[model samples]
Target: MKIDLTQDMIDQGLTCPVGKRKIEYCDAKEVPGLYVLVTSSASANSSYYLRWKQHGKTKHTRIARVTDITLAEARSRALTLRREIATGNLTEEREQKRKQQMTYSDLFEEYVTYKRPFKRSIGKDIQFYNLRIKARFGSRLLSSISRHDLQKFQADLIKEELSEATADLYLRLLKHSMSLAEQWEYIEKSPGKGLKLFNPDNAVENHLSKEELKRLVDVLMSDENRPVCQIVLWLLSTGARLNEALKARWEHIDRNKRQWTIPATNAKSKRSRVVPLNDTAMGILEQLETEGQHETLWVNAKTGKRYTTIQKVWQRLRLKAGLPHFRLHDARHSFAAMVANDGTTSLYAIGTLLGHKSNVSTRRYAKYSSDTLQSISNHASDVIQDAMNGDT
Candidate 1:
């Protein structure tokens, strides 16, 4: 069925009959353009589409509110669109030009300045977005972005010897940011639509071995940097993100309940999170609570100021443990892996503790076999036994 559209359709909205049909024509003042409505199935729930093209070579694209276009409005829109097509004035290129004025950096700056300050993961996301998008590709207009551009970025990252996972994260960030741009009408479409990202699921596990973990823990305990030591141990015990642990405050803790409440303002998902403090975590907090004079729980020893940089201390500890390539983030992974092995915590709990916003985040830690799990538990058991046996 083909309906001749008119102004009434645009003003009052049109309902397509229950069948495969198209809008053959439209009236002026009904709509600013012409449309073709397509229904794939007989079911009312099936999506209806409105498609239009600018000129001979321009491709047809989907339009919003296909159902809302009344017959008169549809006809009006169709006639105008036909005239424009005949005159060769309407072009996809022109439409694209209108969209390309907005860039990734524009949206990123807005998100960081306006949306980010209200979220808990602002610091991490700020670093991730700046490094991944705005610092490199952000200046470019969004509509001008193409798969070739992403390919170049990927190739550049590969030349820099960045891992497949790291490169993929950069790509994913682009797609996600562009998706937001698309939603906000900053771009007509997502340029990342056809690009493929590297799959990190095929990558080898980079978790620490038992001896390495023991050595790392020992080094942290013995190091004269007690603040960093406490921070490291707290990270290990609670499986919290570095920034989350760093920005932790005395007010967030409930000593009587042995729980830490991460306010929505400080949480990754913009939702409040409750972390049940383990005995190890509680002990560290009790010790720090007594010593900390600043608003934050973790403080610098030399000047009794809030500590800011743990990078240097982490590097030394990594070297002492004979694990130069290991990242502090792996400690959170180790925590989840160990907990999975012990069967003491659920994957959901582990994710909650680590501020992972999805089940996929915890799933990565649950891939160990029964034997690998036993090994993890055995190491934790041995350490506990040694601690109980008066080993310093």
Candidate 2:
């Protein structure tokens, strides 16, 4: 039903008829399909909308609130919308504009929600966003972000004394987020395309020597550092990541088969792998099995809880062992180095033992694998000896 709506009618208030209280809309008398939408609250002002049928489908578009626009203005806007609908152009243009206006904060929120359930590193991503990305670019429109803005951001991070690697990580996260935005069509294109990453200084690869390993082992064997000792030993033996070892559970281990399974959730690569337990790794598990009543394989004897970190204890232990500074990750490197140095093991075998997802990562230890080099040298020496003896 259509009724001529005036300012007085709007100001004095128009109520839905008693029998039509369930209806949400009342149409205008002059403008067909133009409506004043009513709500359940009597005090609430009605809003203007246009509802029309085109090609057997209903299209509803909001005009404005009663307080914001006069009836004449609503009629004018509704007429324009009607023309656009007849021409078949308004809806897609309106939605495209809305997507082009999406801001960094908007995309980040959606990204976090989509990633939280599936991504293991989302916590770190959130930390990176909060600490660095949010404050500078959170409110900025995604379409407005440019290569220059990213370059400036990189310079700012460097000026703040962030290491090149850390600064690159921030840029990488931004690039990744923007890439997602592009994939989701929140932005037309990724602005981070063709951005050059900062070249980080060469990192020192620390591998413990036999003497140093002995000293470190002795220090770890002390009563106070036993929990950390066992953890480090496991790390050394299996070449598993620190977190993988810390979070190991008895259920994931098959002692009789001499295998320990690192669940995909607990692993960096998000792929579950079975690590063959060496004699040393098996021994540590057996000792812990006898001592631990809980389901977790590695736990603090004193607290009977999983060990979160051993950084503090490790720092002091390394100092007492008279070893040069080395991170806990270096233990994994040392394991790879030891295996690679053994004359029989191939780099592929070493990579398999370390549970590396790709051979590219395993290639870093090639320079440290003396076995291959030794074999090449021995072959050359044999050729030279054969020439000297006129055997060839």
Candidate 3:
């Protein structure tokens, strides 16, 4: 039977037929493909169903019970579902359920647990996530994070007075985490798939010039920020990264060999590297020993905690040194440049000293090698003189 669905019509209920009709259905006149199904005698409940012909096949789904929903609501819902049926968008409920699967925080905790076994920079990763990424995406669902969202985030990071390298590092971690989400089927695809790292050009290293280095030394001698300055001194002395120097433990130092061993957990390369210490580095260690006997190499006296970042210390020192743009990582470059220009050290020796795992990374200092520069200058002088003499 067919009728315009109404509260009064539904309230009256269906009349019984003479013979045993197993069931009865009435299609609503106001809305197409909407019907009420009544079971014969066996069941007292009735249900509203939405039916549609899709892709040459008949499909139907239960909307709601007649008792559970009002007649107006059933018709309104039926109208929406019918439009969606024509558009083949019937799986919106499944999409909503997918969005509730996992949050970025949940994924981050799981990713960290998976990575802590072998990732040397896991601590840095967690720190960056907490500082930069968590506020934006921590509670957001894995399935809901879109490429545009991450792109905007990447844009915001660069505008926040952070270096391009720092911003890129933040995105690099996100790219890997989201890639894992895609691989694990938590998300349909990684939103960071197309995100680009805005790697700064001519940014391989930013070593200090001799004049700037002298000024920095002057400020280091004058500054009262001893704890942070100590880390800066360690970095300048051994070319050790800030993290490697900050996390240095007393046990990792070989007093006899005058060598500092960076464990795989603290080493950025994920392998134990031995940094040979000079008198300058050894002297700093000796000075630190007089302060305390703790396993940690450097602790902030004010906080009594292991150092995380020397950014503020650097900001003050940079202004004082009049090298306002110099970054803490530049200390490593300055140390490498110092060694490279000594006229005796080879590129291979420079790489080993800095504990660089790759030769390509050490090659950036080729121009700084005095031997290489002097040899090139001699070649040019000989070529011009010889050519001038040859004509005579």
The best candidate in terms of TM-score: 2
Expressed as tens digits, the lDDT of each residue in 235-283 for candidate 3 is 9999998889988888888889999999878877667889999998888
Q: For residues 209-310, what per-residue lDDT tens digits would candidate 2 score against the true structure?
A: 998888888887774666688898888888989999888888888878999899988988878989999999877866665234777776776676888888
- TM-score rank, highest first? 2, 1, 3
**Model 2 spans > 4 angstroms off:** 1-90, 199-204, 221-225, 289-292, 377-392
Residue-wise C-alpha lDDT for candidate 1, range 321-340, written one tens digit per residue? 88888777777777777777
- Total clashing pairs for each candidate: 26, 0, 0
Error of 2 at 326 (Å): 3.1
Pairs of residues clashing in candidate 2: none
The global Cα lDDT (0 to 1) of model 1 is: 0.68
Scored by lDDT, model 3 comes in at 0.80
Ranking by lDDT: 2, 3, 1
